[model samples]
Target: MRSLIRILTTVKELRWYYWGIIICSLLTAGTALLTPFIIKEATDEVVASLQGRGGGLSVVIWLAVALLLADLANTIISNVGGYLGDVMAARLRTRLSQLYFHKLLTLPQRYYDTALTGTVISRLNRSITETTQFLQSASNNFFPMLLTLVASLAITAWYSPWISLMLLVVFPTYMWLTTLTSKKWQKLEGEKNTHVDIAGGRFAEVIGQIRVVKSFVQEKRELASFSRHFDATVGLTRTQSRYWHSMDAARRGAMNLIFFGIHALIFVRTIQGVFTVGVMVLLIQLVNLAKQPATMMSYLVDTAQRAIAGSKDYFEVMAEAQEREGLADPVVGARKQLAPGQPMIEFREATFGYEDGDNVVRGVSFDIAQGERVAFVGESGGGKTTLVSLLLGLYQLRSGQVRVAGHDITETPAELLRGSVGVVFQDASLFSGTVRENIAYANPDATDEQIERAAREANAHDFIMGFEHGYDTLIGERGLKLSGGQKQRIAVARAMLKDAPILVLDEATSALDSKSERLVQQGLDRLMQGRTSVIIAHRLSTIASVDRIVTLRDGKVDEIGTPEELAQTGGIYAELLALQSGSKRDRKKLKDFDITA
Candidate 1:
């Protein structure tokens, strides 16, 4: 009930539409109530004419015309109310969708670290859709039903208070019955949603990585897993449906017994001349009108449960802590200039970790002077990427500070800090779009000439022009149509187009062949010309040209020196270099340090 109320309150901007819907619904209920009264008047007049006490055929004809007009009015009013309901529902959906999407954008990066793409998408679609549908149903039905119940009872009481009292008893009886099942039904719904989210999350993951699944021959395994989740939902549905229908049957049985007793009393009253025939007709019609709400009680409860469950999910996500960077904050056109003589990037005693994990980067302090080039050389899981993530402000440090442009990152807006740095990850991470769109992703306003210049600098111009459409050529998702090297070059071009003050190349060339690596390395060299660059590479050869190297071991800095200096330290970097050499003596020496290639 609270979730339903919250859903309505969240959309207070649409109050005018809600008012329109309410007015139309009340008008609809008023017209429906007028119906039984019209019929009673016509019947009474016809009986008077039969007894020769009526004004004549003309009086009956006019009453018949009154009935026709009332029915016509009811038809028009009902349609108008329905149209208003539809408009209100659509507007509500639009408002809710905007809210959910905006929340997704503002949520912290950490929320997405463990969240699956499909699960997130599924939750947004399912929760909002369910909430909107229920709101629409309630708006169109709930008001009118309540009005009918109240008005019908009032009129029935004027004729026979005993019948009115009987009609009133049905409400609490039905409500008590529905309330009994709501909690259990909601519990089952929550469990089912978990399974569905997992299934949907896995489905999206498999589709996104179909190549891996196909290569590993795990299609059957994935299909079986997907089927298992849905199958579990079916089992739950079987139990839920059985329980709900059984309870519904019992409620309906009780309603029948009450209505039977009410009708029996009405007949006895009329037969005893305690009420006239016209009064009896009106009373019976009112009783049936009151029954409508009672009959609809079960359906309303079911829909309300679905909406409540969905709204809980929606609000849970909305409640997540958003990053300091507001979605509306402009990342571009708001770059903070570096203070003179300040390091372009600085990590001062920085410490960080993933959720529920030990620190991945601990007490790591480093500085890169303006226009200086540096590289981090370490094995996998050595905290190299974790450090870069911290530099980008993707995760908050557990202790200490990372400064960008002489401003502590924690004190600065994340947008301002990230806006000054450009990154090209190993995966390229291109969206499905035209080549030109991909290059100008960061700076959408980049001109054709500027885009071409960046592409050329990244060594991607010739290959892109080789396509039939040149820069306008379509690249499939993540640029799947392009080779590994081609994707890497485009990623570099995108970073180049941003033209930020700092650049981080994270294993950018580690996935390419020798020929492609050399071509891409040439572009990297050109891109790094005068920027403060940070490179993370597993292969030691790529960072040899860097002015200094920072080698990490177990999340702490093990060595910091020029390539020549680090080569003789017999540290992690030297041991890696030795393993790369593949000589018998170098291999034997690596064993002394407990290092493995």
Candidate 2:
């Protein structure tokens, strides 16, 4: 009931179309039910004419004309009602989709982490379409059916009240049956959707991580897993379908019993001379009209239940609390000239965690002064990424505060703060677009000259020009066509072009080969200059001479100093350096690469 009400409220704005539908539906019902009475009048006129009653021929001709007019009106009204239904269905679908997509964009990042990709996509794509179809079917075919049922009963009761009593009693039983059957179908539909979600999520997860699957030779195992879910989904759906067939059969059987019994009663009454031919015809027509709603009861209930069941996930998404709005939008159009002094970025005893868990990064404090370069070097899973996440305002702080340019992260609008910070991640993600567009992503409205300059600075100009279409050539999904260094360089160019006051380099060169590493390292050096930069340092050599290095141990800040000072102390930072020193190849490469200098 709540679901139906929600759908009504959503489409309430388009009530005029519904009003149009209602009017046409009433016209259609009136025209159809009136046919039996008109035909009976014509038959009586003919009988009188055959018997040589005076004035019979003229009355019979008028009666014939009336029946023909009723048929034409019925056809026209039905067509108009159907057309209005189509219009209402279209509006419902379009509006519901808009609501869902708008809600999706406002949800926080954690929602994506916990949710399955396949389930999310399915709900977004199919929920609105199915819901509106059910609503339209109800309004067009099932809802308007009441007009036929009600008018038939009134006319029949005028002739014989006993028959109307039987109809009233039978209506409730069918409705009860429909309600009971619908409850079971709704649960089954939910199970079916769950199985489908698993299958789709598994397929997408495997494909997206195909490299890992191939490396580990687990493709056969993954296929088996996916097949199991698919088979289960099919088996369950078949069972549900069989159940629906049985209910449909039951509905039809019930309608037939009512039709035959009514006809039998009318025949007996006619023979008794208590009922005339016209009264019998009216009863028969009314019985058939009552059957319209009964005949469609099972289908109407099933479709409504299925649509509501499918929307379970869709409603859950809308119910999720949206990310808080930031205090301001990005300050663009004209660049602000920032005066250099003090820490541009600061954290004081900041802490954060997921859900009810203990803080993943705790009691951390640091400062990046304007135009100063700093690196955070730590072992894997040592809270290096958490600190970066805090800086980016990806996670709300569990305690304390993260201040960017003297504004608390929570108070500052995300886009406003992020606009000043350009990030280059280790896993460089590029959309399917031309080289020029990809580089210009940071500033979509950047001029061609600005794009070329950034490309040259990142050392991406020559490679971009090498393509036949150059900047116009299409890069495939995730920029798979480009080599590792080429992708990294483009990412560097994008960040550089933003020309933000703060720069973040998240393992920018760690994933590249030795030759590729050197090229990418050069690009990073140019991007880091004259800005407040924080490097999530993995390759220790690159940040050996940075302004400072912060070493983390077990979610807490352990040490902070220059590389030389930390190496001399034999602290956590020294231990990390020693671990890398044992690898002579890493040592030689570090020596060859002078990235920070």
Tens-digit per-residue lDDT, 1-597, candidate 1: 898788788999878877887777777778788878877877787788899887788877887787788778878876776777778788888888889889888777899988999999889888888888888887778767778789899889888888889988888888888889888898999989999999999999999999999999999999999999999999999988899999999889999999999999999998999977777888888888888888888888888888899999999998998777534333333225555776877888998888878998989998888888898877567888888889888889889988777777777677777888889888999999999999999999999999999999999999999999999999998899999999999999999999987889988987889899888888989998878899987456788899998888889998899999999999877777767687877676554332234
- lDDT, candidate 1, residue 20? 81
Question: What TM-score do all the candidates reach, one by one?
Answer: 0.94, 0.89
- For model 2, residues 115-225, the per-residue Cα lDDT tens digits are 878667767666677788887887778766788899888888888788887777667777766666777778888888787778888787887788899999999999999
lDDT of 2 at 55: 65
Error of 2 at 182 (Å): 3.3
Query: How does model 1 score by TM-score?
Result: 0.94
